[model samples]
Target: DAPVPSGAKGTYALTIEPLTAIPLYASRTLTSSDPSGFTVQTLPNDRGLVSVPSTSEDLSILQK
Candidate 1:
């Protein structure tokens, strides 16, 4: 299975066990409004035409 891209709205299968044991790096901090660590704001939305930055995160396996 391929991992989904960020800023994508949908359901994803998250293996918590694997995540907890590894180092997961997010492009940005999770807002209080969303706590699932899924929702991410790419760009600042204000005007009609906005340039949204395309951001991506990384996941690495770390040693304890």
Candidate 2:
């Protein structure tokens, strides 16, 4: 996960890459359902990236 920059506040994209090549793969964005302080942005422009507020609590990411 990408760390939020100091005094940085706003929506940002995350970068995602595959460890192994897979056929018929599709891309999409993965946003937080309850974004109280921080959230994730998974778009083509920013895959596997997350947006963080200046002041936020500890966060955990769970992949299905």
Residue-wise lDDT of candidate 2 within 15-46, one digit each (tens)? Answer: 44567776334444344446535544432333
Q: Write the per-residue lDDT of candidate 1 for residues 2-59, one digit (tens) a residue.
A: 4455587988432222236665433333445455444563332222343558977655
Highest-scoring model, lDDT: 2
Give the top-scoring candidate (TM-score).
2
The TM-score values for the models, in the order shown, are: 0.16, 0.23
Candidate 2 lands at a TM-score of: 0.23
Stretch of 10 with least lDDT, candidate 2 = 39-48
Worst-scoring 10-residue span by lDDT in model 1: 41-50
Computed on alpha carbons, the lDDT of every model, listed in order, comes to 0.44, 0.47
lDDT against true structure, model 2: 0.47
